[model samples]
Target: MKLAYFPGCSLHSSGRDYDKSIRMVLGKLGVDLVEIPDWNCCGATSAHVTDENLAVLLPARNLAIAEGMGLDILAPCSACHQRLVIAEEELKKEKFQKALKETTGKEFAGKIRTLGILEVLMGKVGPEAIEKEIKTPLKGFKVASYYGCLIARIPRVKTFDDRENPTSMDRLVDLTGAEAVDWPFKADCCGASFGITQKPFFHKLSGRLLDGAGDFGAQAIVTVCPFCQLNLEMAGYKEAKETPSRTPLPVMSITQWLALAMGFTAKQAGLSSLLVEPGRLRETVSR
Candidate 1:
């Protein structure tokens, strides 16, 4: 279970809960995550389309740092995973590799392998291992597993599964003895930066996810990325200016749910870090 873990900038800042929950749950599973020393930003939302060289170099520097450790990079954030994976793919090409080498002073050999923590949990740890550790199964829970654009999107560059209705996360949720609900807006975008910029857009989008979850009688909606969590959870604050009444649905990172299923303390899973008040819905999930 030893892997090079990259938490990206957001995890340390606005998304510390994602990092906390991940480390806590993975620790309970006996997984060793060694952080990449001196790791830089993955340039997730901004750099790619705006600054060409930065898009490659930003992730290239992180990839090179991971390469130095001689371990595969395990990124919990889907955006970071996508960016790093894209960097690995693009840097392997001749023109991009030349630019990366010029900026980083090290020729990236593409030895750096990137993985979403979800991938490791589902495929590496497998459903059986997760099931073995479940102390309180979510027997009655009908959950909507939200896989945002980055992890499964971006074509063959960062993609490893069917982008349309990828079932790994949903299956993992189901293996915890819960019913993976066929909620609408499963493959729909949750309006990432539009959460701040074009917030009105994702308000409707986030509400759609919430409406779908509520309609299916889901206990909670689970996601792997902080951006998705923010977009869905923080919608009302911004969207209220336009159209209000956004449902305050609880969106837990998969790590939070896993730790809860394993019967770990809420403190251990950083469940207290959630913005949405899930306490009211305890009976819905814990029954």
Candidate 2:
């Protein structure tokens, strides 16, 4: 299966592990990723907050490029996915379509669909297919599947999973032979860009998530959003330092964990780049 892959800015930078694991695991599943040529930023938090028109147009340009390829887009970053999805919806309207044509000189037919990583996994690549690729099941590892906020909570947009309580990530975690601990914060917001603008508030929000995961006995927190993973890991690290008795839960992209289960080495999956080392994951895989 060939699809247009949009990794966004974070995937190439801070979320290199996510990008590596996604490419490796999808390759194993025979899914070819054709990156959109000259793709621009989706204008996530910044553009959306400052200029609504620019926000829609930014992703609209990328969508127009993908439409030319005649393929659906698989955006690994939840922020990118949300932006692309929102742009597609807006382009369907005559007003935005005209604006896109006038500003960017591009005509978007809105032919392709934008999907999140979780949707691509659960909807396109079934659990049965993934199970067949697992060489080493994470039998004893327990993880809290963190959906963050964007993946399933876009208003007026049809999401793949339940907005209030998503189970796609949990189900995928189960296929990896890891138990997905039931937790309330799976779909909660991780304060997104607030981690930069409002440090203390971000810490308080993310800290609650970390504490909740530990409270539910999760050894690690699994997520699909790069921002969410970074925020959670940063929060986990800070919390650990503040309270030496508390163990920091390693935050991993869902793809990272899947790649490990599919027999890829830690280095190949980019686990070593994580701020908090996944020592428990290594131990569990070794057993």
Best by TM-score: 2
Q: How accurate locally is residue 157 in candidate 2, as Cα lDDT from 0 to 100? A: 86
Q: Write the per-residue lDDT of candidate 2 for residues 37-154, one digit (tens) a residue.
A: 9999999989999998998999999999999999999998999999899888888889999999998898899678998888888899888899999998888888999998899988
State the C-alpha lDDT per candidate. 0.79, 0.90
- In model 2, residue pairs whose N, Cα or C atoms come closer than 3 Å (at least 3 residues apart or on different chains), thus clashing, are none
State the displacement of the C-alpha of residue 77, model 1, in Å, after optimal TM-score superposition.
1.1
List the candidate 2 regions with Cα displacement exceeding 4 Å. Answer: none
Assess candidate 2 and give its lDDT: 0.90
Query: Can you write out model 1's per-residue Cα lDDT over 213-242, one digit (the tens) per residue?
Result: 777877688888888887787863344445
Top candidate, metric lDDT = 2
